[model samples]
Target: MVREKFTHIYARAADRKGGEAELESLLATPLSAQELKGISDDRWLSAFTQKVFQSGMSWKVVRNKWPNFEEVFFGFDIEKMLLMPTEMWERKATDPAIIRHLGKVMTIPENARMIHDAALDHCSFSAMVADWPAEDITGLWRYLKAHGKRLGGNTGPYTLRIMGKDTFILSHDVEAYLRNIGVIDGGRDTRKSLQATQQAFSEWQQESGRPLCQISQIIAFSQGDNRL
Candidate 1:
């Protein structure tokens, strides 16, 4: 049933009339944040390292200093990071070129270790995601706790949504981003947001549903790279 709803949304969003062109536009022009997240394996380490640098700093500052972070962090190579000597850690802790928060600066190694552990247990860092179920947002929160996610807050769940790990309806950013694209209003609170998402899903199920493959084709038509 949930899959049906997802299929429907993809179909409608991927409608062809304006979808293809809009998708082309988005594919042609990349947003900075989007580009950062989309980094390939060759640069994934660099991107993740950049994410750590921004942990306690404003995203804006992190954005501006991304190049420097990449350079100093050795392009995000996990092995290199894991093997970083104590002296190098000290240097980074005081480096004005990076975010200089003492605690965050120091915890980089520990955080990397946690990520490595998660990868070992789950086959990939992405395996950590199975900690949460997709159908229930609240359950997802509970799952995070059980799976050893230290940061637990409303914002944590929202972060999961933003990171595309969970597709719960409490996605404030998705709601707001969709609103910006004129799909839904931004003023809706969490309850209303979930309701809207539920209704949309319900509606899609009632219509003839498409599979992930065919749905991809329709999204190619309707959603058109608007990233909706």
Candidate 2:
């Protein structure tokens, strides 16, 4: 099966979304490396923690309760988070002030430690993530999965995206497009499938001169019934 070129994809998305300008308006741009580097490690930890809690749950629910999460986690400061004792974690898990899932709540300290360690190695977690090669973003995803708690699958990808890292998310629509284009063959999460996705997106990025995020969104908008 032949794969669709970026031009064909973009045209379909544009037609569905009310032309080029409308499609562009719907697309989100990723941050520059310098911009990503300037963000604090605390923000990185907080963003990933938010994604962890939002996983398999209502994102709006998490958003509504975020201020409380910030307060309970002490603004997600790496040092302060690392200092939290096991007893404190247990207590906080049951606290009505935030989501009470012990498993998700526990991602805080371990992810904090991961970010803290990254900071020591790269001056800041922000610096490391921002510096990661977008061309091989799956590598960073793997790194996060190996190093951080509850950060595998789309969790890591979502956090990187929230932090403005230039990465693509394998969303339902995006995955569907990939399968339609023969870019993905079998199980969606398999290493082979992921690498195929990366390669396809890289080609599209080169062809369209668009960031992976934009290209990913364009593909999603092109394929799904989510039209205007």
Candidate 3:
């Protein structure tokens, strides 16, 4: 099984790095259910927007200006964002507080509407995210891509990880590892590749009793980078 290959990689990484404890240090602890529930929907929106803007830019830049982004976006209030005038958004294209890219600037309202619609249907965006089964977390990624604007590719999964969801990030390193082990055949983001990755994670979870986040980090760590 793929889990055995991954375990061997982990063992090799542990040996090179001194011990299993060092490998553990490279992993981030996923948020508990209570912790996840405590996070507000607005915060989820902020996280989503952050990931969207960080897509092709330096995350450090986005992170550094996040406080100003919070102020300019009206604290990411869903309703307010949904109703914000076009002129304000246009004006923000020149704002120093946030990334001034017009295209990225435009996604704010569209994504806000996406979050608003999800909240309308599921009570709250946070609730919708909190309710999805972690075992099929890739399905959540699919849902976000289909329903939310600018949430395609790894953005949705990364956003989920940022929100403390027990999800995996199929980063290039992880994908390469999967391909090397034959869990997947190519790097294409097609449904087949996604399903293969999802099934592999499912098996690993059942075999290891670990969340997708930790499994993903382990796979990355197994590659000897240990920086996930």
Best of the candidates, lDDT? 2
Q: After superposition, which runs of candidate 1 have C-alpha atoms over 4 Å from their true positions? A: 1-56, 130-132, 136-151, 154-159, 169-228
Candidates' C-alpha lDDT = 0.48, 0.89, 0.82
RMSD of 2: 1.3
Q: Which candidate comes out best when scored by TM-score? A: 2
What is the per-residue lDDT of model 1 for residues 118-154, given as tens digits with 9 covering 90 to 100?
6677654444553433334445455444543333334
* lDDT (Cα) of model 2: 0.89
Q: 9-53 in candidate 3: lDDT tens per residue?
A: 668667766789887877777887767777877887898889989
Candidate 2 stretches with Cα past 4 Å from truth are none
What is the TM-score of candidate 3? 0.92
Clashing pairs in 3: none
Candidate achieving higher lDDT, 1 or 3: 3
Rank list by TM-score: 2, 3, 1
- Regions more than 4 Å wrong, model 3: 1-6, 224-228
* lDDT of each residue in 41-92, candidate 2, tens digit only: 9998889989998988999999999999999989998999999899999999
